[model samples]
Target chain A: MPTLRRDFESRDDLIAHYREQFPEAAAVSDWVSDTRGGRDAAEALLDNVDPVEYGRTRNHLSGAVTRLSPYLRHGVLGLAETRDAALAKVDDPSRAYKLVNELAWRDYYRRVLAEIGDAVWDDREPYKTGLDAEDYADDMPDDVTNAETGNDFVDGSVRELYETGYLHNQQRMKLAAYVVHWRRVRWQAGAAWFLSHLLDGDVASNNLSWQWVASTFSHQPYIFNQENLRQWMGGRFTGDSVGGGSPFRGEYDEIKARIFPRA
Target chain B: MNENARDKAVIWVHDEMLSLSWLGYVRRAAERTEIVGAVFVFDDTWVADERLSLKRLVFMAECLEQMPGVEVRRGDVVQEVSAFAEAHGTTRIVSLASTSPRLRRQGEQLGVDWVCEPPFVELPARIDLKRFSRYWGKAKSRVFRTTEEIMEQA
Candidate 1:
């Protein structure tokens, strides 16, 4: 094996070079400007974490989520460094506890991966919901992938994921549930799609999370009603924005009755 | 570990552990175990999958550029690593221990020296690996402890 040496005069040049090699990834060329990969940039992002705000807004679409997953996923920054940064931000260690706990989830998944190895791709346990693993379809719906799902929130999230190579954490859960439960698609299919696009996609984190939504790793399937989306995402992706109708617009009980009639 | 002994060792940096501190730690393990060179191999078998995103490749390339003198190669991981070691005149290969099953398997196959970094959490000897809460309860104290404290305990 011989060493290959090449240099980029600018970030744009690098993106262009990458595009030439992988033309199918043109949807994400614009994303390169937002994410500059290197140690210094990672440290700078870590230095600006706000634990208090993060605890409050993490569940919202426009949350104060520290977009540091790309660096953490790639090993530009370590878990200890991020945790230390969170603790340094406030007087009480407990104040940063929520942020640290989330970081710990990443570590937890890694440990699970270490133990399970390739079995992470398999369901850890049977689905808690009425349906069995064999009941789900093996392929992702083209409607979902192409952002033509007719559901405003889901479509918006899909576009965000493809165009930016990232998504809000809450949005990820909702989307995962939609794919696994609502659409009856296999969690593995959704996981692969996410891994192909997410800048922070680690196999353990992404697949295990999909399993969680699919009820294979959790107590119950994670299904969200339209009201829940409306509460968090505001009116931008509901009602009139969705042509005066939305599949996710009903009350929780109505959604439960409609989506899971057998349950 | 004599001062001159360091000159013979080669540090193998993989994509999973790109931190300078990790490399520096491995380099400083012995008085003169100065890194003769570092190598980053892009395994063709691993990257052939559809899930291997271009962004990750670009990010890895950027990371390799950060290291002062890391030689990049493309081929079988074990073969590339072995060739680099042979060319550098050192059979000893040092790398950070990784959780990836593939990387761990490669480490064993290459017979490399693996260094364990301080983990995000330190678990009890007996752990219920089924759930996150149970794991967190057992490892929370150590997880929140500073790196300095961890190093002191080590």
Candidate 2:
């Protein structure tokens, strides 16, 4: 019933303000764990740190892109203002360039929706239309709905989305790919559910991103197996080795049948 | 048809969930012109959502009951308004611009005069540091990888 505040000054101040404003929101901002060593430990490992040179780390990259999507979607934040702020903080053009590229991707998807006008749904190259809607019904499929996908990585990401209206950029893309390319569900179906649930869900970004993953609009389609899914979605859920147990163990034939059944 | 008639019948056509400010439009319009009929359009898809709570419907029903000479129509807002206009012989159609583009376009296409009302709740636009921080944090955190962890650590 309550709405999130619609304005903010700088990044650091906003984080602190959100923590102070909402008690439950404390966990919302925590991307990586202070404790490390375990796969679940969210320690963002920096490949190298050079303020002068600017470095890339897996943690930094995923964390940065995912965090802003929610705010920008809600109209609480503007892309231009954020970009200007970054430029003000650091003089390094390379660092600013990398960050700006991420923002451009967000804008790119918006422009795609504005220009294409929902033609993305009409294409239906790989996915069987109306199949996912039938399988998932009003919600997601039982395997996903029942949380018995046996894939810890899949389950963990789903849990993260349910708990916080957030997911890392890489994880979200992988999830969409798994659903569309591997699971063979319609991208819009998945996108619709995301829009209803995700607090930060933006129509342009969510719909186009799902299309991009489904390979409906994209030139290249991608299928994420257990290994790729495991790596991106923190680690597996069962505390066993990555891809251990039946977590990511559904047969391809079975998946194909369930997702893209014999026409 | 005299342009300046003392007793003019005005009809308000709009979507569901009437805001407080929207209600104000009804009050003011009613004062100026005789509010003969008010039609609230229940679009097909919105009805299907099933997620729209009972409270909202009750609130709308209550609002409709309060207005004088207000006629509440259930499906296809534009159609309802057009039919009501013809039946009641409404001289000039009065509508709030908060309605959807489809409805707005349909209204325009039907050759009805429209009046766009500005936002009712004009909260002062003071530079809110707290608000700025929240959105700013969200924006920075997107690419500010350490932004979350660094803040969490702090």
Candidate 3:
């Protein structure tokens, strides 16, 4: 066991230290996130939380997201503390309802994690897509991993996840669907990739959420049409066919029919 | 409570309890004793086995750097923590409670004292976790209320 040096001249210095210390991870990707981790950064984000706006606009990519998950995921801020902070932001408690309810999701997942332990990596239930576990690809496709998918929405999402180590919840779900449903890859592959990169990645939240999109832990598989992606993206990415090669161009029913042909 | 009791106690700072506020919580099941220092171990197993990316490591290191006076170590969590405690001339290792089984297992091996943070909401000893809606059905009523309000109601 070796003690790590804490003093740093700058963020670049700190990143270099990590690159040297964990060469394998650096070899995986030398990316660094702009999201600094600390209580000061956490509280600053907390102070700007608009519960009303969050409720109205959270589904959108550019919405009032609170960007507090990295702090929350690391236990830099406890669930109760964050809930109280959100409540204190609003005059009425109900205005904080959506934010608090979402906190309950983390709490719920944690409880599930405690109960199930390492089984978080296992499929909790059978896929609802009428596809067996063996039917899906075990490894993620290199194009999706390398951000060469040629589809704007999926490729953009892959780039975002890799570069920023963060993804909006909508993109997370849509990307999970793109992998599990459209690509016929296993949810575990997507979950593992996400866990490796996401700053806020928790085994329970990441894996179970993957299962939800994969329909292994939900009543139905989660899928969204191009219109849904476009609407929530706030026009950041087209979610359109870049060169007429996107599999996401259809309606919800059409997508379901195409991806889950057996179901 | 004599402060000397904590001259031997050290808080094991995990990723789950990075808040300075959490440092104030003395582990449950321990007598009121001051903690002399804190140590944060980057679990070698997680780093190597999980293949955690540089971005993840960098973000975590940034968080650790922000916390003043936390000794950082990278190795097997249980071994590193045990060695840290021994180097400080103590067997007592206190930490904020975490639901992470990996941490829990290491804590058991080291006999780390765990300080339980306040629950986000109170629930039955047994409740459904099969689905969010089902869990929320029970959680929503209490969730809107503060932990204090719920305790008062109870």
- Which numbered prediction scores highest in DockQ against the true structure? 3
Error of 3 at A42 (Å): 0.5
lDDT winner: 3
What is residue A231's positional error in candidate 1, in angstroms? 2.5
Off by over 4 Å in 1: A21-33, A234-236, A239-242, B1-7, B30-34
Residues B52-133, candidate 3, lDDT per residue (tens digit)? Answer: 8899888888888788888999988888888877777777888877888888888899897787788888899889899999
Off by over 4 Å in 2: A1-55, A58-66, A124-139, A234-263, B1-154
**Of candidates 3 and 2, the better by lDDT:** 3
In the range A1-263, model 2's lDDT, one tens digit per residue, is 11223233543444444344333323322321211111111112121223223325433223333244443442223454345455555656456656555565664554344344545345434433324334433335667644467666567777676555566776677677666655656677678656544544555677767766665555545454554454544543332333566323455555444545543
Query: How close is chain A of candidate 2 to the true chain A, as a TM-score?
Result: 0.63
Q: Per-residue lDDT of A183-259 in model 3, one digit per residue for the tens?
A: 99999999998998899988988998999899888999998887777889988877765666568877788888888
Candidate 1 - chain A - TM = 0.92
How much RMSD separates candidate 1 from the native structure? 2.9
Q: What are the models' TM-scores?
A: 0.91, 0.48, 0.95
Query: Could you list the CA RMSD of all candidates, in the order they appear?
Result: 2.9, 15.4, 2.2
TM-score, first chain, each model? 0.92, 0.63, 0.97
| lDDT of each candidate versus the true structure | 0.77, 0.47, 0.85
Ranking by TM-score: 3, 1, 2
Task: Give the range where candidate 2 chain A is weakest over 10 consecutive residues by summed lDDT.
Answer: A34-43
Point out the higher-scoring one by DockQ: 2 or 3.
Answer: 3
lDDT score, candidate 1, position A36: 66
